[model samples]
Target: FDEDYLDPDSDINKMGRALALGGELDDFTASLKDTFTTPGSQWQYVSIDTHVIGMVVRGATGRSVTDLLSEKIITPMGLEHAPYYVTDGAGVAFVLGGLNLTTRDYARMGQMFLQNGRYNGQQIVPADWIAASTAPSAPTAEGQIGYGYQWWIPQGATEGEFMARGVYGQYIYINRADGVVIATNAADRKFREAGVSDQNIAIFRQISAALGGT
Candidate 1:
């Protein structure tokens, strides 16, 4: 959380090093000062954890996540324009929050998932993967903001309801029962306020209901 990442013993120095000095799994420390408990013991919202999954994908497939995203998801979705990922000094793409895509494209992605991974008459991504990824499998406490593979399941979310959220007010809200997808981008400073996320989800629900969706 500190900008002075040069200190060797900083909280997130390993991740900073991975971004700058060509990160390797061996160089990473599992938790920051043991603040986190045993793995799978609980759910913690850490963006760096997303990078580990990206690295695993890169290592196992011998391909960059960016390239795979372009080939497998972006291209097949028939987006209006090509999307890009923000990278670190080591050219490693930030798979968690670095994706830059048009709002329309975001909605298209939501629609794809809504259709169970079929887009433009093609099964771009596997329906089973979509189902599994959007399920509430994470260890987040019940009645709270649930989580799936990398998606957010807001409180009071009905079945097949999930979202991809950003630090700001950015969101790609999807509700399959309603056949709705709402993509939004915002920079509201009060995004972290209590009830903000719930309010946003409520608004989306109202909109979906208005659009003849569930």
Candidate 2:
């Protein structure tokens, strides 16, 4: 975690080259760890932290995140297909943006959250965990957008409005007050181009409003 050696561009190249060279999976994982260790005490949003979180969960449960999620959520939710995680050379799951699920499957997760972690008459995730994770718990400025345990809350949104988001424009927006769940997946690399995210949030809000959000 050399602060001066934090070259994300070069890291991308290294990952690609390692894959091309058929390096062992452990090699990639080691490189990933080397490249993505925490930078500072600041609250920067690092995607690698997701992997670390998964490691923590695995350490606690002695099971992979994929296995836990599959047994606890995916199978019980009756998903049509099992979600997958992109893995390192050693087959360790990338717990952040590596998950791949169909739109309907994603919606099921959102609906579960909208129901306070209930799905098909059972609690998939703990209701208290849902409540805690969807609240504003980060160090963001007052009145600015807030971050919870892996969840994102738009600026000025009500307590019942929060979302799970990923790179690109993928989102599962929930408006609990209105009983609305919106799931979207996008391939827009330029999703950050001016007004895009705001527009997307506006659209979600509009949809929630149309559904009678409080």
Candidate 3:
């Protein structure tokens, strides 16, 4: 069966809910097996492969995502509030969208990116990783939004203009030219509407301009 796991109506979504509720890794793998095997062209736009990322990180470092993140990023950044993730019953951190962080913490991350991965005189994320991840590397159509490694490069954006976007209008916008970072959290049910993403970017640009990032 050609299972569109990205589809809300698909069986994978049901399995995803179970995964969210502390299901096992084997269950998630089974869900994938029940679906299509090969990735389609749309794979460029969406991929639910974060489980593999968690596995790789653990295998490579022999540490959990929460531990690595806390020791490497959170603690070094000196965040006012510690971030957390929804985990499986096995305590495997959800590598995709399970992270819960305060808006201030989000901005701190954006600022770190803006400063080439340095925060409070400490190197959080590697500078090369920041540059490579934020670069326009995705095969997107011209004048459309572009995807970098887990980051978004808006249409018409120059170098150093990128965002970390999340569900329900959550955003950490960085404008390096004018030294601006904007963090926002929202409960937007209409986020999938046409032009919503563009409008959000426009609003962020307006905010950036207002903050002397022009």
Candidate 4:
């Protein structure tokens, strides 16, 4: 996220409706050229960065995203149900926001993070990565919900408080200090409404506080 793409008439926005319907990703990426010749010059929430990284992994590993996720995580987590990813019209996995999982399965992921990436007596993800990624290191606005590697650290986050927030209303909030994991799901398109995210964070903090008897 190092470019400015806020223009309503931006190339990506021109066919955004079609893209939402099922346009090819090539068309989408081509529409939006890389604006940041040098990254770290700025910080913007450009969603395509993740899809590009997913493609890189696919290219480097000669493996599908599903295969890698299943082998390295999903199967090991012993989820109650199999998960599926939503693909684009070209059949490429939509790496950004296409991962679909059951609420319990997501809670398992949250629990893994809560335990510093350990789950089911095994280290699923490196504890160091879990700590570093969830840290509020991003250059997000001060006093707002902060962005970590891909997690959300609410303002005034307490010891081990963070969340994974889906573009849709899916949220997995974990408070390690309280040993609480709250996974919620919704399709409210109005989730972007003002104060919605802050309100949700406050609610999660309240829940955690009550559970911790603090």
Relative to the true structure, candidate 4 reaches a TM of 0.87
lDDT of 1: 0.80
* Candidate 3 segments exceeding 4 Å error: 1-8, 20-22, 34-43
Residue 101 error for model 4, in Å? 1.0
Please provide TM-scores, in order, for all candidate models, with all chains considered together. Answer: 0.85, 0.84, 0.87, 0.87
lDDT of 1 at 169: 84
lDDT minimum window of 10 residues, candidate 1: 24-33
Candidate 4 — which residues are off by over 4 angstroms?
A: 1-22, 34-38
lDDT of 3 by residue, 148-195 (tens): 888999999966999988766789999998799999988987776789
Of the pair 3 and 4, which is ahead by lDDT?
4
Tens digit of lDDT per residue, candidate 1, span 1-214? 2312345765455566566666643245344345446767877777767767887898899998888988998887889988877777656677657688899988999999899999999999899999999998888876688898888888777889999988678999998887889999788867878889888988998998888545
Candidate 3 lDDT (Cα, whole model)? 0.80
Q: Which candidate is the best by lDDT?
A: 4
Q: What are the per-residue Cα lDDT tens digits for candidate 2 across 52-148?
A: 6777888899997788877888899998787878776666766756689999999999999999999999988899999999998888777667899
Candidate with the larger TM-score of 1 and 2: 1
Clashes of each: 1, 2, 0, 0
- The runs of at least 3 residues in candidate 2 whose Cα sits more than 4 Å from the true structure, single-residue gaps closed, are 1-41
